[model samples]
Target chain A: MFFLSPFELKGDIDSVFERDPAARSILEVLLCYPGLHALILHRFAHRLYLARIPLIPRLISHGTRFITGIEIHPGAKIGKKFFIDHGMGSVIGETTEIGDNVTMYQGVTLGGTGKHSGKRHPTLGDNVVVGANATILGPVHIGAGSRIGAGSVVVRDVPHDSTIVGVPGRVVRHKGEKTYDVSLEHGKLFDPIESLNAKLEQKMAHLENRVAELEKEKRRSA
Target chain B: MFFLSPFELKGDIDSVFERDPAARSILEVLLCYPGLHALILHRFAHRLYLARIPLIPRLISHGTRFITGIEIHPGAKIGKKFFIDHGMGSVIGETTEIGDNVTMYQGVTLGGTGKHSGKRHPTLGDNVVVGANATILGPVHIGAGSRIGAGSVVVRDVPHDSTIVGVPGRVVRHKGEKTYDVSLEHGKLFDPIESLNAKLEQKMAHLENRVAELEKEKRRSA
Candidate 1:
């Protein structure tokens, strides 16, 4: 039976208070939070996996997934003070490497692109916050202090202190602020599609105005 | 004490066979499929909810969600043979209404806009297939035989026999193919962003050629 170090337990609890404003008490965090439960269970399963215990580790992982709705593969290496808030439908693949002080919201997938074998999942650096329903696929590196916006599908590497958003996510902000606070304002992020559509509309209006001017010139000549 | 009707059970089982070609035996489906487990549990919880049993229905729904990773609010009304393949992260909101023969994949959210109180969730018509991670938000109506593509976020009503895709979903195909089959070819779907980029590139090429022709004519005049 694998047990959590007292330091790890304290760090996990402290991280919850630091991240979630709604976390009222330690008892509530311990009992009510599925994310916390999942992480604790993962620690146990990971220990079993490291010990070369075959089927039992996977079974434990499966049971944890069923209970928590957060599927973290037993083989995934997670660092200290890792927090997942409202972590339903979050899938961490076997090869995923998560660094210290990493926070992930619900429906975040650290997955493979199904192209290559071995080390296919994402490697997240320290203090990375991934937003809701954001998919970081393939063996991409998410550098430290980066924030990935909600509903973004990131398939490429993100540099340090960057903000990523949109499908095939682009870095909207890079290396601006050192102090990283998790931003839930995903709606405020730049939408490339909407921007393109607005540009097209402007072009159409310009063309129409030019056509009207040409018509007026033709009539004046006549 | 709410139990499924015999017809409902048979229909649910039949749908598994129809949709999943790999489904060989009834026993395997009954025991192994988490999707089926969720649906069966929802039937019970939904009945309790309709009966106005306070707290019990919600508790039942919570338990089912915990086990299946598919959260269906007890207040939601789902029709017969509603199949959810790889049902993890699939959320059905409280006021959502789904018609018969609706199939949904994993990570699909039939959710609300959170701006309204009553009837705030989507209403999906018969023979509607929602693909993986597709979010149909608000009190929108999805017409019969319509297909929502993978990762599409649809906020408005969809017409019958239409195929919707993209971030703020646009109908790419409409009024064609009466027979609706669940299309997993999400990669083949028309990407609006890519199309816009291609158009821009073509315009630039055309302008470059026109500029070269103008320069040639000017040189001749000189």
Candidate 2:
């Protein structure tokens, strides 16, 4: 059994209401939210892990995973007011560290790439929002207030207050600007691939026109 | 209680061994493998759904979701020999259809757009392989032998024998050719964003060189 402070528990509950529009009541959040369930379980498991209690901590972690579908390693360190919305298939690695007021959507992975030992997972700063199915691999740092777009694969460090979108994520906005609301509207995010293809089409048209003019000039001279 | 044919049961069990290299033995697969569990449960639920049993089928679906972390609506039609590896966070919407020998990875969503009535989900053809975290929305048809890459969001129809990649997926390989093996190696898939960025750099360089030459020629003539 794990003993949790009422203040900390209230803070976690408050976070769900602050971030999620779908949260109807405190009773509903308490009974239905798997994210909150997993967090509470992890806190207990983490304490056992810190106490050097071996198999029990791992067993509790495994049972929590079976129930919640969210895998949080007992060795990971998570701060206050952490909220994971629809947290299915979300994985937090052993060496990972997450800061306060962090929000993550479903299928997000804070994972490692190689088999190297120490500090092999990501460290997320305060107020970081990671969208659905976003994978952040290796020992990278995601700065405070950064928003990672949905379905993005990030393998490198991201700066503070940046908006990261696309595969092998490129920093699209870094002006410390905030947009829209806290709720993640994945469809509204900028389509970088579409934008690039458009630019490519424009350039190709210009080159074709220039080549045609050059051909006509040569013909006239001849 | 739901009765399943022994032949269909064997086929489903065999699929785990065929598709996933991690399957050690029959006992391991039967005890583990949430995909197999979810599929078996879905078959039972689907039978009840066709019989027009009201809340029980939906209740079974909900219970299955709780255990497996894979949500398959009772109204969805699935095919034979289908395999879902690491089935967490996968959702199959109502009116979604699948063909024989189709394989799906973790976090895949066969979903719909808008609140339209009939056939709002995707229909996948035989031999289609959808990778991890890939989302196929709307009532689009995925042609036979097509491979969808990891983390790709596809909203439009894809042609046969095509390899789709990137966000809002583009057909990267449409030659009716196959590559590597069946098991999805997400890291090895063609990165269209990187390729486009390289092409853009080359085009910009060529344009800059041509502009410099034209300026020098004009200066000489003057």
Worst 10 residues of 1 chain B by lDDT: B179-188
Q: Give each prediction's root-mean-square deviation over alpha carbons.
A: 6.4, 6.5
Interface RMSDs of all predictions?
A: 5.9, 5.5
Highest TM-score model number:
1
Cα displacement (Å) at residue B138, model 1: 4.3
**Chain B TM, every candidate:** 0.88, 0.90
Stretches off by above 4 angstroms in model 1 are A1-33, A39-66, A71-86, A91-105, A109-131, A136-150, A154-164, A171-190, A197-222, B112-120, B138-140, B155-157, B167-169, B182-187, B205-213
Please state the i-RMS of candidate 1. Answer: 5.9
For model 2 the interface RMSD, in Å, equals 5.5
Per-residue accuracy of model 1 over A1-222 as CA lDDT, tens digit each: 588988899998888887764455676577656788899999999998999989998998899887888899999999999999767889999999999999887799999878666899999999898866789999999998888876689999999888886777888878756654434223235556777777876885675566556556655754
Predicted structure 2: clash tally: 0
Could you give the fnat of all candidates in order? 0.15, 0.19
lDDT of 1 at A81: 93
Clashing pairs in 1: none
